[model samples]
Target: MAKLTIVASIKVKSDQVDFVKSQLENLVPITREEAGCVQYDLHQDNENPAHFLFFEIWESRELWQDHTNNDHIKAYQAATEGMVEEFVLHELTHIA
Candidate 1:
């Protein structure tokens, strides 16, 4: 199976940007250590402080699914609940 690519876009409420960003940053080290994680990078939009993006590459869809079930992920969900304005996720297969 080919590697999986995930693009996650998160838009936080303007007042919650700093708090949400801290929570998002806390996810990086743990996620990078997970199995099948090739790359896990986070970005914040320059012009829009409330916008954040995650570019992740996983070894397989199955492994990425496992990642979604992790404790830290659940904790993140709980911590950021109601703070986000919009959330979007895209899963892609690299083809070339």
Candidate 2:
């Protein structure tokens, strides 16, 4: 099976950018240690601090689904509640 690629974009409230960034940073170490996580990277827009993106590669969609259901993910959701202005995620196929 083809590996799963995920592109997630997040926009935080103007006033909560720093706090949101810290929370996002906290997730990286933990997520990178999860099963099937080939790569997990986080990026912030240079000009727009409130904009954040995650580029992730997983061994399979099922494993990625497991990741979404993990306790850490749930905690992230709860911690950032109301601070996120917009959230978008895409699952992609590596066509090459």
C-alpha RMSD (angstroms) for model 1: 0.5
Please give, for residues 19-95, the per-residue lDDT of candidate 1 as tens digits: 99999999999999999999999999999999999999999999999999999999999999999999999999999
Tens-place lDDT per residue, model 2, 1-39, is 899999999999999999999999999999999999999
Best by lDDT: 1
Clashes of each: 0, 0
Give the residue spans of candidate 2 off by over 4 A: none
Cα displacement (angstroms), candidate 1, residue 77, comes to 0.7
Please list the residue runs of candidate 1 whose C-alpha ends up more than 4 Å from where it truly belongs after superposition: none
lDDT of each: 0.97, 0.97
- Predicted candidate 2, C-alpha RMSD: 0.5
Q: What C-alpha RMSD separates each model from the true structure?
A: 0.5, 0.5
The stretch of ten residues in a row with the least summed lDDT in candidate 1 is 76-85
Query: What clash count does candidate 2 reach?
Result: 0
